[model samples]
Target chain A: MIENMTEIAISQLLSETQKMKYEDYRFVTASCVSLGDDGCDVIYHFDKDLEMKHLKLRVGKGEELPSVSKIYFCALLVENEMKELFGINITDIAVDYGGHMLLSDEELESPMAKQQITIVEKKGAK
Target chain B: MSKTVIPFGPQHPVLPEPLHLKLVMQDEIIVDAIPAIGYVHRGLEKLTETKEFTQNTFVVERVCGICSCMHALAYCQGIESLMNIEIPDRAKYLRVLWAELHRIHSHLLWLGLLADAFGFESLFMQVWRNREKVMDIMEETAGSRVIISVNTVGGTRRDISKEMLTKISVIVDEIKEDLKQVEAAFFNDYTVKHRLVGVGVLTKEDAYALGTAGPMARASGIKQDLRMTGYSAYGELDFEPIIEQDGDSYARTVVRLKEVYQSINLIKQCIAKMPEGEIVVPVKGNPNGEVVSRVEQPRGEVLYYLRANGSKTLDRLRIRTPTFANIPALLHMLPGSQLADVPVLILTIDPCISCTER
Candidate 1:
């Protein structure tokens, strides 16, 4: 509902996020919403002087998305979270965890993914 | 010099919440710090998919025990926006009252934890002892000590009577008096000053770049606060964001300590200006849109993003907790610091792993 929310291409996410930084907009947070089998929507929220701007990106499975951590270091945490929990492949993270940050062995990994059980069961069998 | 890797947490005496930091140190100085969380992750955000809009209020409240009321308020505000409901004036005032109370209690809890971190056990006991008064106020009004589940979709679930308001005012006065002593001890005590005065310095530029929130940013002279957005009854209240230019551990301490007094004043203003009206309005229809709600919690800015599809359960619920935002700031501050001062630096941000991992 926020007027400043703008949808951008997956390729433009890094550039747009860098532009927000140059415009003095603080990187607030990032979120990922599953769009079923069509892939997921990654929403990046930014703010300056209480005014907010959201940049959304749509990416499908096997698609590699650029990381924004180079522009905003704080993005690393959320990016790693998205990679681990949502199974999004965020490439070139400034501080790459290589898929080991929040999730552990006892937990259900990538529960937000559409084929969560299949992925986990496959990994478990190994 | 040889390098050593020290795992700071996941089980530490000073940390009440579980947060693991892998500190790469060169002798006594930290070279790099890598943080690992999710020990307390309950996947509460995912729970919103199965819970109804009304029931999800409670689910969000449980996201963090310290700032439960703010979580509920943010969730309710998002849902209220979705349903296009204008909450009653009295409900807004009541929400602010409970929110300020939560702030006071949360800061007090953090101050106590900081004291314990520095081995000031007696100070920690005294701070928690005074914190009990705020807990009593919450229990008396909201019927719960920590997770005061008074927030609903259209309005609040509970209301305070006129007599109860007077009693709360009296208790707040006593709390203000008690906080003065705690403030003096924190600000003037030699040990606290020596340990915290110049430690963990995050300059204004670094703070802005790192996107630190609440007292962490305010302490660094950013002057950023979500309360300035005037959500709930905050627009009607008269108060200023407590700012400190030092950007050190002591500055962060001073900001929180002074904000305790500010919260007390805000609560008083809410009590005096509270309008007489219905507390709860009947909410109709399921939400079918998206909304972003930001609230200033005791720790910092808590953001909630909600999306619904004309159904009882929400489609996606994302909570961007303050501690989650502050972790990067912590990572920035850890390097170039002595190993022993790590606890103080960690506590300076008032990191809430429960909220971060939720």
Candidate 2:
């Protein structure tokens, strides 16, 4: 119905649901990087499967997007799991700002966080 | 009267798996029920992305020990469909044979557990004693007691030898006879009927609306069996779904009991109709595609959606287990029933929280 597992389908679904009167869908989780670094994996699980199709929406980073979970219920868990697993943050949605069930408190920074690697050496042959 | 909230289990005597239930009761009548899972979460979906297609069999089989073979078969079938691999005729029949064997053992295990839940210790022992036959057969054939890692990407790992087949058929006949005794003991027992009948009444609409599947939905008069779609060798076998119209706890017990008989018959049918061919095909190349597979697990319809991206690992794997889908429906059926009926009613759907959480 919503373009069979893609980002455009997510946008189309969000737009269609926005036209309806329901307005409680909140982003519970938003975390995931695509395999080849070409796209992202966004899991938007609506309490009512009708409100939104459960999808792994793939898109390039830094793309302008409309927040969709605003029209669904209980998406916090999906967002939380994603955030914990992928380390992607949703600026627009209010987050609980803690580690999820999968990760411990001490290991808050996700393992998958893409930190730049810098090597320093005193004396080396070029 | 103030209602008291009692935490039944993440580990309780009644529940086998680690499922925490918050029960709010007013004078022994449960008013509200909240199910909290995630205790047994193993990040299985995440594991699929790291493990190779062939290596994922053992991992998938451990999803639920009782439905191990079915889960492995489902995962393999998903990959098989994606690769468009045509399984050998013998492998199909062997798969069907093991599937039916697992089904019978699973139902018997549930029946035994249900009996114990109701304080019928002897019935529990009797049913489990019968269960050992299938377990013995599994151990003898597959070389493992619970997680029979028989399934592979293209076909199965174990093959039933002609000599083993004859012995299996003979033992199956013995199990069939033992089942008739159980059938009489269960159906004729007044206490069993008094405890189960009309306790948990799920109407047909409630069953469908709540997305209940497997025996619970079948018991409620909804003719939905994944086998009808003819996955595996079910199309070749001669069997019909065991259905009951009462939609009560007792009806569910009856349905499972009859299904045990059907599974035995179905196993025999597989033996009679098995055609000779290779047990497994050598799978090469990375599986790269999306495929959806449906299998009739002991509980209900289990849906697996697998996406592979031409690598040693999968791109994404989504599992919609039967108990996960049936939980909402079970919650709806709980409020109106008496407190004592809770365990029996809960068992009616055969709650497999491990399968659900995984």
Candidate 3:
């Protein structure tokens, strides 16, 4: 069964994550999504006993969010991915890649950001 | 002894996908292993932002050719939940049938690759030869050997008739019979035991703490399987998660080998209990909410998070592939391992770089 989506303030992200860890929920994965002009929403998924609990944090473009990599070591990969792909300024990640983890030096910068090229659809008579 | 650095992939004989592991070795033992991925990242998740939700099934299926059906399944389930459409019972059984078939083929493929990793050439060929039967079944049933695009948003695109189901059942039984020899070789063969046993061990604690999934987690005695969640028809089926406590490369191999038989049994049960109904239901309106769908892929549990904004396209399509989740466990298992065993250890996790990177 699906659990209700829980929205938490950016300030409560760490404390809530710690509580989940104390409750023995396995850190599944973290997802970062661009919400256009309304900044971005970072959802952290955790699971225990086959039930899922999601803790979401919404932040502005220039906001520096805290990383949960220290609590959930596996979050390193996803955290670095967010920093590189979406330009999310994650603070004090455990195994920080300095913005070069998944992407290369030559690729497009922060492709998931709002200023990225928009994919336009062309209509044609078939 | 002086430390030597070895770059493991991005192009390697043993790896079919590009995953570079920077190995820091002290003589014959690897002290550390740092993984560098993204060599083959196609940005398929980003593509979902542009492609229509219906069309993205094909795109997501290409995430990994090996576990394409599971990828499609997860994406379709998420979209179906968003649209609040109940798939037909027949479609659910058909999905389980095809999913089990995919599992069997994927395990067989890993068996072949594992055999090849340890220089068991003839055994590798035999395992793959058996795998061809499954591939042929998929081609005949789904019209594609790899990347079967049978799943849509509401339901499946193809339906298997009772006659075809009987044919599949016969083939599955034949496969089970053929697998005895393969299982025997994996269990009794000296070379395989010597190379795999007590190598690349990850204890139960490390397995959970690092969040490993699928066979890797099962091998470590976690008793974690997404199938237990009962997405689709798995809840209706009678089965148990295969577990091994040894938590070694050999244990991982055994888990997968036994799971192949488990998948065969699951398919037979699905055919016996499959309900008769329409395969696809009409789904109207756009998805306006978010949903996270989880499915048990051959490698592990794959999570697809889809957010729709009441549009034809999705706002975000995030895939937490099994391989990506297993990377931390890989990093943990690498150190304290002999340099020569790196290939076998990497294969033990069934590293799908394309899936991980995408």
Expressed as tens digits, the lDDT of each residue in B234-316 for candidate 3 is 99999899999999999999999999999999999999999988999998989888889999999999999988889999999
**Where does model 3 sit among the CAPRI classes?**
acceptable
Residue B341 of model 2, lDDT score: 85
TM-score of each: 0.97, 0.82, 0.96
Q: Which stretches of candidate 3 lie over 4 Å from their true place?
A: A116-126
What is the C-alpha lDDT profile of model 2 across B7-82, one tens digit per residue? 8777767788887778888888888877666677777777777888778878888789999999998998998888
Model 3: residue B305 alpha-carbon error in angstroms: 0.7
TM-score of chain A, predicted model 3, versus the true chain A, to 2 decimals: 0.85
- DockQ leaderboard ranking: 1, 3, 2
- CAPRI-style class, candidate 1: medium
lDDT of 1 by residue, A61-106 (tens): 7578898999999899998888777877788889876666777755
Give the TM-score of chain B in candidate 1: 0.99
Clashing pairs in 3: none
Question: Which tens-of-lDDT digit does each residue in B1-358 have in candidate 1?
Answer: 9999999998988898888999999999999999988787898888888888899999998888999999999999999988899999999999999999999999999999999989899899999998999999888887879998998988899999999999999999998988787777899999989999999999999998998999999999988888888899999999789999999999999999999999999989999999999998998889988889999999899999988899999889999998888999999999999999999999999988889888
